[model samples]
Structure formats: structure tokens, C-alpha cells
Target: MSRAEANTNSPKRERIKRKKQQQGRKDHVEVCALIPVFLVSRARNLLYSHLMNSR
Candidate 1:
């Protein structure tokens, strides 16, 4: 199982984990970066569809 593999690989994983900790929360930053663009595109599509339908 992957859990067993990770247990075996814990030393390497720990090193990588420490490196990520030093890198200042990259996962949160990436999600934050994506959300606004996703919302904006959806809003723009809905607005365009409404405008077309109103004509």
C-alpha cells in the first residue's frame, strides 16, 4: 500500500516536507491564485449569455 511505501520512504519524505515548509505555504498560494480567475471566467460567461438573450 502507499501508506507502507510512505512509511519506508519517511526519511526522504521528511526532507522534502521540511523543504516545503521553508518555501512558505505553496499549496495555499496556488489555490488562492486560481480561484479569482475561475470565478471571473464563470461570471463573464453568464453575463455574456444574459446580454445575448436580452437582445
Candidate 2:
């Protein structure tokens, strides 16, 4: 491998790494946001099922 090739590739690789990190963070935040919604829906379903059974 040539020094110039490594030099050119390193900056591009660094940029891609930064972009990937940002995307990962965004995905994590989306998952965090959805957790409460998921829990609420799950709880609602369980409540409805229990009420139906009690009827």
C-alpha cells in the first residue's frame, strides 16, 4: 500500500465513520421514543383482553 493512497482514504473513512455514528445515535433515539408507545399499546391490549374475559 502506498502512503498517498492511505492518506486519501483515511479522510474519507473518517467521514464515513462520523456519519455512521450519527446515524446510530439517531436510531437509538428513535427506539427510545418508540418504547413508551409500545408499552402503552401492550398494556391497553392486555386490559382489553382482561375485561373481555371478565364479562
Highest lDDT: which candidate? Answer: 2
lDDT of 2 by residue, 1-55 (tens): 6999999999999999999999999999999999999999999999999999999
Per-model tally of clashing residue pairs: 0, 0
Compose the digit string of candidate 1's lDDT tens values, residues 1-53: 99989888999889998998967778778889999999999999999999999
- Model 2 residue runs over 4 Å out of place are 1-7
lDDT of 1: 0.92
Cα-based RMSD of candidate 1: 8.0
Predictions in order: lDDT: 0.92, 0.99
TM-score list, all predictions? 0.60, 0.72
Q: What is the lDDT of residue 17 in candidate 2?
A: 100
- Model 1 clash pairs are none
